[model samples]
Target: MTSGKAALLIAALGLSACQSVSQFADPLAPDIVREAGLGEQILNSGDPNGAVRYFERAAAATPDDVAMQRSLAIANMRAGDLRAAERAMDAVLASDAATPQDRVERGFIAVRLDDWERAGAMTAALPPDLDTARRALLEALVADRARDWSAADAAYARALAGAENKAAALNNWGVSRLARGDASAAIATFERALATDPKLFAAKNNLAIARAMRGDYALPDGVESDRERAVLQHNMALVAQRKGDAAEARRLLERAIAAHPQHYRAAVEQLAALEN
Candidate 1:
């Protein structure tokens, strides 16, 4: 059988006994259970190293336990151990006790690994509804990476409508709109994201682009308070060019590059625009 077929077969077989496998010896010894609780706190606190040790001990005691395995997998991924993460995912998928959520998370790892074909195939098999929304988001990410603009736009819109302000979803959704020449709508979406989180670098950078497209020199109100305002000013120059004011745009671009010597794209484009 092909890899895709093999993966599907594995998914089908593993899903059959998910409940039973998850019931494997609960690694809930009083001390260990306390550790497990603390691990969750650490995970929530974004301390992957602390969480990993707790999860590792929990998995060791409940070797075949699906929940422990899932925790282990997530901790490993957070700790940047991709190989260990894949191994945990394999164990989770091989058991008859894996949940639909397990399969979805496996698909997530595949996407992070840039295994788009596998992500597409695995997500295609997920149950619809909430699962479908998650899959749609992943497909949007894959499509964005692959430069399939139309599919990406549709997928992201679906995901955003279902889960508002999901940072990655929102950022990519705006990207798809920008890709398709829907600058106004893209700008709106990007700005909404900025409002949701003032310090999100990707949203800030993207919002700058959208503002530049509209021929505006303003940074997203207060974003420049913390971030380098040179980027915002540089983007404004591009907006000037877009609005057919090449001279003003060139001057602004030159000023930006002078202020920040690393603004290579702005400098090159401004010089080229001047020549033309």
Candidate 2:
């Protein structure tokens, strides 16, 4: 898969920008909560590195605060500091007051770290009644990672049944199919995701990837933020690269990086590789 495609798949499965400190019910010091709230705002504003600085201070002030630790972990993850995220998540998980969501986040971190054993164990231990959709989705992810397509499919079906955001489940299911080398099924799945929620930019980008993998040049159409448009352009560039149009690929990648300097790290890396 192209770098852009790989990045999109990772983004789809990873912690999203919409995640809030409010999701956790853990009681926190007022000072720590205020600091963590500022960190979350920074994270949502597209500056994970900046968010990490604030979150770290909050976590340091309240060493035993699970909520601060969780915020720090997410900020570090967003900043692409997996080791920092792992440490923070471990702290959260070790806390006696860790919430169910905390466990789920730890499982997610394990998945990102490719610690399949821990991921499976953590997710498997989740309360079946709490956040059923998330549990099912995580189970599907683990099944997909194990290359158990049948199990993945079953889990994905359950996820769809319980999900409040069916579009996200559909997009993830399509990504699983794509990983299994079923471009046709993946394309159809992405289409269904888009039909379910037209504003799902990730699904639109994934649709472009599936089509490109099938040797189609047509780009997916949608209205999006400048960053999202950059991502779409990066995906098209990947398609061009795969088609042996190196010049066009280079142009598009460069354009994508220029369009969103703060985001699109994969595009920057790809452009650098092309130059080298």
Candidate 3:
């Protein structure tokens, strides 16, 4: 794929951002309790967009409430509204009640935003003696962003040292390996991640990508949409081309064009370029 297409493919895969939220419980607060509780319920039901309105109301009712703001931030992040998440997190961190975990959360948001400096600053703002898996996850992410492979690997090792949920960090590390052109390592890392958490869809999809990089192109079962199939085929075509298998690339591109619901301009253009 062209760099633009590659970037879009990675973005669409939704692999970059990863975080956890505590299970929602009843709040003792009177004014915003109902709103916040409803928001968490909606969010837990996997309706982040639906949760946002309730979270907004709760945050509005108690502007400086750190827990409410944290909930809102998580909801916004889950909904892919990074800007809104940043705003909500800023509110949380500004409050006196912000915890060390909140600082790491803020740093993670910064990493997702590609704000490396702010991410580093957030990491620095945390208590120097604080050692947690989330903090190490942020460090790995920052190192990955900086293309410091050794540092990233070390940080990821630290992140997974004793963390019960090793899948997410392993997935991130696999992505970094893919970025570094280590398809074999990436495949192994993704497999490890999936072994840790069979429910991690990102690891499964990424494993497919890694396999395709080696010219073993096969679409995952989870890719259902016509457009999604087309995108995968187009990406696999690019991978084949990079591996010097022009014929395989052409075949995959043809399949992509056939699979698309509408005129698939990118695949068509790639095919034309290959023909030339």
Candidate 1 per-residue lDDT, tens place, 1-276, comes to 233332232233232111110111111111222334534565555677777788889999989777787778777776767678778878988999766666666666776676778777777766775434455666676676576777878887787666534654566676556655666877787777667666655667666665665556556665553225556566666556656788867777666676676544656565675778
Please identify which of the two predictions, 2 or 3, would achieve the higher TM-score against the true structure.
3
Where is the poorest 10-residue window by lDDT in model 1? 17-26
Q: Candidate 2: which stretches are off by over 4 Å?
A: 1-47, 223-237, 240-276
Better of 1 and 3 by lDDT: 3
Candidate whose lDDT is highest: 2
Candidate 3 local accuracy as lDDT?
Answer: 0.70
Best-fitting candidate, measured by TM-score? 3
Query: How well is each residue in 1-276 modelled by candidate 3, as lDDT tens digits?
Result: 343454344444342222121111110111122334534466676687877878899889987677878888877876778889899888887889877777777776776677889998987788878777667777776776677889989988987784556787677778777766677888898889878877666666677677876668887655657776787787778767766789998999999999993856888888999999
Candidate 2, which ten residues in sequence have the lowest lDDT sum? 18-27
lDDT score, candidate 2: 0.71
- Whole-model lDDT per candidate: 0.61, 0.71, 0.70
